[model samples]
Target chain A: MAEASDEQLMLAYRDGDAGAFETLYARHRARLFRFVLRSIKSRASAEELYQDVWMRVIEARATYKPSARFTTWLYTIAHHRMVDHWRRAGLSVVSLDTVDPPAGDPGPQRHAEAREVLTRFAAALETLPPAQREAFLLHEEAGLTAAEIAAATGSNEEAAKSRLRYALAKLKSAVDDG
Target chain B: MADERDPKVSRRYRELGNEEPPPGLDESIVSAARRAAEHPHAPLVTPSGRHRWYFSLGAAAVIVLAVAVTYQMQQEQPDPFATGVSREAVKSPANGRARESAPPAADSSATARPEAATQAETSGRQGAAAPEARMRRDEAAARSLAKPMQAPAVETPQRMLERIVELRKQGKHEEAGQLLAEFKQRYPGYRIPENVVRP
Candidate 1:
């Protein structure tokens, strides 16, 4: 079958078609897993949270409503799950500011330049508050609108805009300093 | 150098700086989803068919018991005035005999003959008992009015299922899920079938 929309796949899954769920999982899993990994910083924890999120989805299948975009809804669940995991572990929230840039083996000069820029950018992203980082990621990586970000974060539109603006300014300053 | 100074620096960063996710993440999530789909924790403790029948029977039994108790109470306490009235009616003919023994008069006898005597006797008995009969009826009405009204039993599972379906149809899946969770908590044993959950 042609690729179905998230809403279509969810509805199909609700209607007892497991394959539709598989399709949805295939479409969203990598991005969701990455998103969780970035927020939580532990590969094993990310994997566990990933399983928990999908299990939540399954438990919630009977009651699924498509009020927001599917990915927005999915990310909200992931966000909450991460928050819960953080709380339970009694770990202090890590400031994104202190993240060291990943240093790989020296390669082509162009590749080296790109890596430096990326490393600086990652360090800058780590400096932002979780909410700001989330807003930025949703905007830059997921291509969500301010409205969608607000909905995902349960914040107002103005707040989402402010966070996005701050995130961009911080990234710009970090890159300049680097 | 000019590219770094460009106004679209933020946009460029976004385009070129996206992280590649770790491998095998998708496969793991899909595997988890498949496992959940296959082994959804539906307890087989109560069959729906038997549960519905039991509910119906319980409701029926309550209604039947209420009616039987009411009937037994009514039979045990017959209305005193009704019985008195019926007794008076049975004894009216005997009382009529004394009225019939009265001497006849020329002017009034023609009009006051047998009919007048019988009418007078019947009217006296009914007049004596009418106030008591009215009081009994009023008391019965007051008793009925004093009883509390019972709300109809809610269709617990079916209504919740329909609500979830309606919410899903409206694309409010998250809210629907919350409501269903609340419903499940409220009615712990009711298994919302897999078919209902799928859509």
Candidate 2:
């Protein structure tokens, strides 16, 4: 079941196989929600954006063709939705809540250290430009290569790589200092 | 594939992406996706393109043509039984050349006392009897002079039509209709008057 390619599953769904769509939904649910949640930083709005992305996929099932990777197409829809949301909200920089420490059985001192690192990382992510942050999200969350990011964001591969580089550098510097 | 940034930081960020959104959000979104997939988007109306308009235009043209033809036909039919025949000559038969037509005595008897034709016909039968042959001859001659129109063997269609009317008056409508039918078959293209055909 897991071995079936995304395109194959989507094609099955196109042929009216409801279970195939369920598989597709399960596969992308966590990753796509996280992508939207991280971008918007508001759980409620992220849920709306998340539902919108999946609706776009469902609406496009009939016209779905395997021209590109499913993730690339999925993230493209996500990127467009995010852009629309940003435009509607009229926000250039996304505001994020302070990051909580990684959940674990770590000692108090280690937990504080993880919290500090996460807080700095979150702030760093907020400070990056929207396109650059999008590139980074596509890379880390959607697991898209630079070329896939380029296709998703309608940019050149070099630009996608540059944005990803900038995002990673700022986060790395924050981690080292924190 | 060449990353300008340190690989360890990027790997750590990718691991941070493992931080899932709330479980409820995941379930809701997935359920929505599946539900949406179950209820597919309604397809839009298929464009009729120009085919429908083309047929409509064709139908409109046909209707217009039919109406025009009907109107033109109505305008053309001044009289249903009009055969385009020149009746002027027959109506004004008193032409300058009428002097060369039928003899005066025959024309006068035919035009004046139409009943004299029966007397002339009866006189000829009496002239054939031997008992008063010579006397009847003189009487028949005088009758012939009075009713010379009956001596001619020519039968006109006008006379035939009048006889048909007379037959109808005497309750011989079937015979009259048979005669008219024979007249129609004999003169296939003749444009008989409506009264003549169904009188």
Error of 1 at B138 (Å): 51
Highest TM-score among the candidates is held by which one? 2
Give lDDT per model, in order.
Answer: 0.61, 0.66
Q: Which residue pairs does candidate 2 place in steric collision?
A: none
Clashes of each: 14, 0
Off by over 4 Å in 1: A90-112, B1-28, B42-199
Q: Taking the tens digit of each residue's C-alpha lDDT, what string does model 1 give over B1-199?
A: 0111224445434433234344565555555556656666652122467587887899999999999999986765332222112222223544323332432111111222233334444555677535444444444334334432322123446766886888788887886786677767777888886644655
lDDT of 2: 0.66
Q: Residues A9-101, candidate 1: write the lDDT tens digits.
A: 887887777799988877776567556656666657767887778767876887899887888888778768877887887322223443333
Give Cα distance to truth, residue A85, candidate 1, Å. 2.5
Give the Å error, residue B115, model 2.
63
TM-score, structure 1 vs. true: 0.49
Off by over 4 Å in 2: A92-98, B2-7, B11-199
lDDT of 2 by residue, B14-65 (tens): 4354555567765665565556556665422222787768878999999999
* TM-scores, all models, native as reference: 0.49, 0.54
